[model samples]
Target: MNVYAQILIDEAKTRGITVKIIDEEANLYRLCYGNNSVLCRESLTEKTCAMAMTICDDKSLTHRILYKSGLRVPRQAIYINMTQAIDLMQTWNSLVIKPASGEQGRGITVDVREKEELQQAIKSASKYSEHILLEEFVHGRDLRIIVIDHKFVAAIERKPAFIIGDGASTIRQLVKKKNKALIQTTGGESQIPINTETERVIHHRNFSWEDVLPHEQELQVCKTANYHTGGTIIDVTDEVSYTLRTAAEKASHVLNIPVVGLDFLVPDFSGDDYVIIEANERPGLANHEPQPTAERFIDFLFPETKK
Candidate 1:
């Protein structure tokens, strides 16, 4: 079962709600409280309309819709031609290329500073999507704000996967050790791929797999801050500023989505400046530990179970 489904199941159990796994492989489950019953597949549920999910599923459409509503979004476009991408890069100086519709940071390339790297990024993104997106690289903290029932529930700062040097272990060794720790903590669900993407990220940082990092130096190994891609999440719910909270809540309202995880790039949570990158209709409710995300979701789905 996906961790998200298990989280809801476990939370339901604590509330004396009946939980039945309808399809383990699909991570589908049913939750019951007296006469009320609700069904969910992972974090998705009936609260999300098909149209909202469809809009969120398409990144290009999401941007257009949100932008038209006057919400801040990174300058992006559905790919038309290689020349268009190059022109955008030249004007913006940095670019982000990724599959127009994907999750968990799949087929995403960040910090494309040159033309040759842009070519490779497009090729990588094309592997996953025929329609690639070229976005102006926005600089800021990567913040994920979770909105539930048109209200802000939690916020987190997701940092790219990194390792601190011990002065002895090579980058390869550090990565191996980090992956093992990630598996242990996440129950083998998350791992950093030891593939060409990893190699490219390190190479761009002027390091090799065999290079021994200086003692206590930090090196970010992955460009994508996604759990499945070895990134770590820090709960920042209490630290969220009013500006960030309102932006997230308003964005959710604009999309008419009751539950969503909106990804944004901001200089800081206290600032008004932020660019909405993507919205996940079925965001992982369990990611913000000790924040009662799963419990709130249950409350929203089965109001009678509320404490």
Candidate 2:
């Protein structure tokens, strides 16, 4: 079972709710609190409309809907052909290429500046979906805001995967230790992949796996701030500004989804300026630990249980 699903089940058990495993393979479960029951496939429930889920699945459509609703979004365009993609890169200088209907930051390439890099990025994204999105790379803190029942419940900032030097270990040794720690922390769900991507990032910084980093030197191992790709999550619910909270709530209202996660690139959490990057229909309730995310989700589904 996914860690998030287990967390929900544990939370339900604490609330005196009856729980049954309907499908262990899919992590589907049935939870009953009194006469009220809900069938949940992960964090998604029947309360989320099919149409809203569909809209959130397509990145291009999500951007268009949010943009048309007067929300600030990054300049983006669909990748039609290599010629068009190159044209966009030449104009923007740096672009992010990813599958239009993918999640968990899979098959995403960021900061593509050259024609060759853009072509490679498209090929990478093509493996996941034929449809691709090319957008101007926006630089800012990656913030994920969780909205449940049309209200902001939690906010977190995701940072790229990085390793701190201990002055005694090689980069490869440090990575192995880091991965082990991550596995222990996330219950074997998340780890940093030591692959070409990791090598490329380190190579760009004039380092290698065999090289020893100085004490206290921080090295970013990946560019994308995705939890699945070894990114770190830091809770910022108490620090998020009203503007960001309001914007995320408005997005949930526009989509009419009872629960959603909004991704934004913001210069500062306290500032009003931000760019809506995407929307997630079934956000990871487990990612925001010790924040009552699963509790809020259960409450949203079974409000009668709330005191």
Candidate 3:
């Protein structure tokens, strides 16, 4: 079973609910407690409204809706062709290009500053979605807030993959060692990719794969702060300010989604300034350990089971 399915099953079993796997390939399952039962696919349950899911899946629509609701969101434009994408890039020197309907940071290119890079980003993003979005690149910490029933459940700050030098090994060797440790830490869910992207980032920093980093120096390997893409997650549930929590809750309420993850680009956790990046209808509950995300999800699913 997938990690998420296992977490949900374990949580349900603790509440004396009968758990059964309906489909292994799809990670589909069913949970029953007495006469009450619910069918779920991963973290998404039957209770999750289909309309809300649709709105969250489309990035352009999500930005439009949130912008209209008087919520702060980054400037964004959707384009279907290379010409349109390049023209949009002229407004901002640095832009983030991503698929309109994609997840897990797949087919996303960030911090694209040049026209050549922008063309490449558009081509890469086109693989996952026909419609692509170009948004002004905002520099801030990547924050993820899990809201259940319009209430804040958990928060995390995701950082890009990086490694500290010991003044001995090359960048390539350090990446290998780091990836091994990461696999053990995340059960192989995350690992830094040693590809063209990694190479570009290293070269831009005036370093090469064969070059040795100085002792105690930290070098970032990836650009996107995605957990599945070699990023690390730090639980910040206790640190999230009330202002940020209120904004996330309001976004969930506006979207009419009982369960959602609001991604934000915030200057800091203590400040009120932020831009809503996107809304995830079925946010991963397995990653936020020690935060009671799974427990809250179960509570939302079966309130009677709550202790």
Candidate 4:
């Protein structure tokens, strides 16, 4: 079983649902619970939720339909050629480049505010995608609204996971130490990649990897808050508020997708203004742990069990 499938099995057990995993092949497995069975189906997975989730993953199609239905999403331009990227860059001063079918913020570059930077961002983002998503960068806190069975389950703020400084260790040392802790934290499913951007941030602050760390209370390195880039996920279930919930519900209904992950940028959820930057299908369940998205997914699949 893949890591995600394992998470589903683990969560199902936690929820008092008896499940059996049967191997159909070396890499394929089937999940059975009571009379209901889910096979190793790939639209990411073969289950009902996964199929619904698939509709949201192909961002180009999702946005096209959702936009017509009056759902809030960033103004997006899809390009398969570098010329088109350059053309779009000339018109938009600030934009973000992302894979049309990417997740976990992988291959996402934000704040390309200049021509050269935009080109480079486009090149990098396009490596993982044939069709690239070039969008106006929405400035606000990143909010993840997870919908299960057409209802909101929970929300999280993915603060870019980073290492804190202790005013003693070097930046390299700090990163190495944090990577070790992260492996322990996520069961070795992810790692932090050292990069020039991280080094440049360190150097810009008059420090090098070998120098003492930044002030304990200050943010010294990196700007992007992505889990794949070593960002943290904070539970903000209560903060999603009623207004945001209503908007998310409306957005989901408009899209006609049963399961979807909506990403928002807003100064405050209590306020009336916000931007729906993107909606994701196959949102990584591991990001929202203890809440058990997989369990919620199972419940969604087996709603008859509720009655």
The lDDT for every candidate, in the order shown, is 0.89, 0.89, 0.88, 0.69
Q: What C-alpha root-mean-square deviation, in Å, does candidate 2 show against the real structure? A: 1.6
**Best candidate (score: TM-score):** 1
Model 4: number of clashes?
A: 7
Alpha-carbon RMSD, each predicted model: 1.4, 1.6, 1.6, 3.6
Per-model TM-score versus the true fold: 0.96, 0.94, 0.95, 0.81
Considering TM-score, where higher is better, how would the candidates rank from best to worst? 1, 3, 2, 4
Off by over 4 Å in 4: 1-7, 14-18, 22-29, 40-54, 80-92, 196-211, 289-295
Runs in model 3 lying further than 4 Å from the true structure:
80-83
- Relative to the unseen true structure, what is the C-alpha lDDT of residue 113 in candidate 2, on a scale of 0 to 100? 85
**Residue by residue across 1-307, what tens digits does model 4's lDDT show?**
5565677666556655666556623334455667876554311345445445666777777777767777666778887676776676667766778888877666676766666666666676777888788887777888888887778877889776566788888778888888898888776655566765466446656877787665674544555666666777888877777878888888777666656678888888666667777787556665777675776776776665442
Shift of residue 287 alpha carbon in model 4, Å: 3.4
lDDT of 3 by residue, 168-201 (tens): 9999999999999889987887888887667767
Compare candidates 1 and 3 on lDDT and give the better one.
Answer: 1
Worst 10 residues of 1 by lDDT: 188-197
Regions of candidate 2 where Cα sits further than 4 Å from its true position: none
RMSD of 3: 1.6
Summarize candidate 1's per-residue lDDT along 1-307 as a digit string, tens digits.
8788888899889889998889999998888888888888988887789899889998999999899998899898788888988999999899999998888898898989888888888998999888999999998999999999899999989989999999999999999999999999998878887877788899988999999999999998988888888898999888788888998898898888999999999897777889999999989988888898998898888887788
